[model samples]
Target: MDVNALPAGPASPGHVLEVLRRGGPMTRQELQARVGLSRATMVERLDALGRLKLLRTVGHQASSGGRRAELLAADEVGRCAVVADIGVSHVTVAVADLTATVHATRRLSTRQDPDVVLQQVLSLGRELLAETGRANDFCAVAVGVPGQVDPTSGANTAPPTMPGWSGTWVHDTLAAQLDVPVLVENDANALAFGEHLADGAPSTTLLGVKVATGIGSGVVFGRRPYRGVTGSAGEIGHVKLASHQERCSCGRTGCLAAAASGRALIRRLRSSGARTLLDVVRQVEQGRPEAVALVTEAGHLLGGVLATVVSIINPQQVRLGGPIGALPEFVAAARAAVLDAAHPVALRGLREIAPARLGDSAALVGLAGLTADAVFAPAAVNALL
Candidate 1:
């Protein structure tokens, strides 16, 4: 396990891949400087990677003197990753390259039966791969479900909505179906990872809040998802709201999700005579007092819950994602409430409260990153082999 004793030169293709994975494309000189390898050693690694079709010489850059240096980039077509987001109402599948570019995507309505849903996922994944003409290049698959996952076993532990999914061997099941290693993650955490990878957030501490059919938060500290003991660290949606009597999908009363999620907002809007979220948005745009009031209230409730999260985690940035989080009015109101409720210290270092840059595909991109990590990281790949 000694770092220095590990294979060097062209033999350390994995290490070179890891460097490219983190730092993007670089010249041999730059790679050597960054990865602490000699020039000859770096060239050897690059040549091996090129031979495997994992890296390609994209272009060249002018050097201080002498010949131009060849710039190398990942050969995305040589390897692909799949990500599946299993939500309450739907399942979304996406295929991406090692650089995290989504090439193809598909979605299907979710079923009550976990096994049926998983089978549908496999079918859709194959369809996407065929559509992208990347069936043979696919290296790994990652799934994000709405629940706590045992990282070691890849088993769902206690997802409130996905009743029969608990105790399911997700990794083994999907791996068997796809003939590739699979990694399962919590949906919220996956979204956070996607945001981190896509947006390139400067802060090492990031909080991603997803306001969909349910409200959940994901925390990334020190560039890694902070899954707490039992892998339920970011279940902020289940936090009890102040003295409310609304019942959550978990059969608990007064959870934040029951009070302020997109479902809750939709329910309130429907009760107030609005037909859909679009209708509510139109009404608010038209200055309909009732619609504006309702959305503002939901935003306030969400921000109130976020206040507690900010106080505890004190993340440098808070990114809103999912249905409600993507709405401009909702974001405005939430930002106002967060500013009013969060502690001064937490607010002092706060960079910005904004919508997720990746929008609806955040979870899918995160799944791709997870898949790449499982396939390319030295330790994870070694375990797989």
Candidate 2:
């Protein structure tokens, strides 16, 4: 393959790298076939990527009767992302490769102040990168907060659960600390993205609801999160319920989250000495009468919001996630309510309501993936080459 022979306008090294990133290792013939490029063009692009240390030969694939083709893969070690899943109660920091392979991880109790939380994520991210021997390999940092973010500016806006987080300039602060690009996402949206990537990058739309300290939802449509015009598309926590009069963190009288969130249940059973949502889950599993009743009711409330969500968007799969959402009893109750409340037409395309596949790590996985995609876009690849 001659570098001088390469044409000027349409040659894309990114395409080859993207194919390898998404589909794993591939032979030259497979790469050429998939990209529909001439063999010479493919070879030139591959060689260029190799010189830039962005692609490498993993192994050789079997051949019919000719020389075996070497399998090419993205040199994920050359670039990675630091991800932080900032929950209401905890912070999970991890370093992941471009393929979303987690290299190192750490968790800490969340801080109440916005700046303190940002510092915790940055410090932990740096520590994880060093532990993974990838101190300078990361291209971006991603953080998923349990609150709403302004889409264009990446500022926290009117966060109900996270005190002192509202109007915080999170993206700029993290970017300044890490000296790299920063992506801030809502926690539930991160979970949905994580589920999407873990589920073999499915083409169908998905809805993931996180029933943690608060209730929030994430939606995936056409391979992108539906963040809506205001970037608060999935703020189901503030959905007003006429029947419940509990005061919500958002200063509302009857929000569904106040009535049905994990925190809500904990508050209801505050006298039982349950410190975390997992304790409540254990009680539910052990068939404790009070825990079962509270979780079931919470599921019913969540299902009401989900019924409206399903009716409007009609996602193919609905994933219940977080500490409380994964419980079988809660899922069953939510499923029944969804089936009862959703319109028949909306129900036609729906699949079974299932627990989130990634469990508590979904947000971290999603943040890593989101970081990778942003850093590996065509323009970024061209710049690297």
The best candidate in terms of lDDT: 2
Q: Please, what is the whole-model Cα lDDT of each candidate in the order they appear?
A: 0.77, 0.83
Show where candidate 2 strays beyond 4 Å. 1-10, 19-24, 33-40
Compose the digit string of candidate 2's lDDT tens values, residues 1-385. 5544544444588767787777769887887888889887787898888887887789899768888878888887678898888888888889987777888888888756778877877888888888888987878888888878778777777456677666647777776666677888998999998888877745878999999888889998877788987789988999899898999988888999899999899999878777788789888989999999999999988998899999999888899999899998899999999999998898999976899998888888888878877876656777665
Sequence-dependent TM-score of model 2: 0.90
- Candidate 1 lDDT, tens digit per residue, 1-385? 3333447443466777777766767887777887787777666666666655667777888669899988776665478887888887778888887667799888887755777888888888888889999998988888888878866666776456657767767667787766677788888898998888875753568888887777777898876788887788888888887778898878889987887776677777786676544566677778777777777777788888788788788888788887677677778888888899999899988887888889989888878876776677655432322
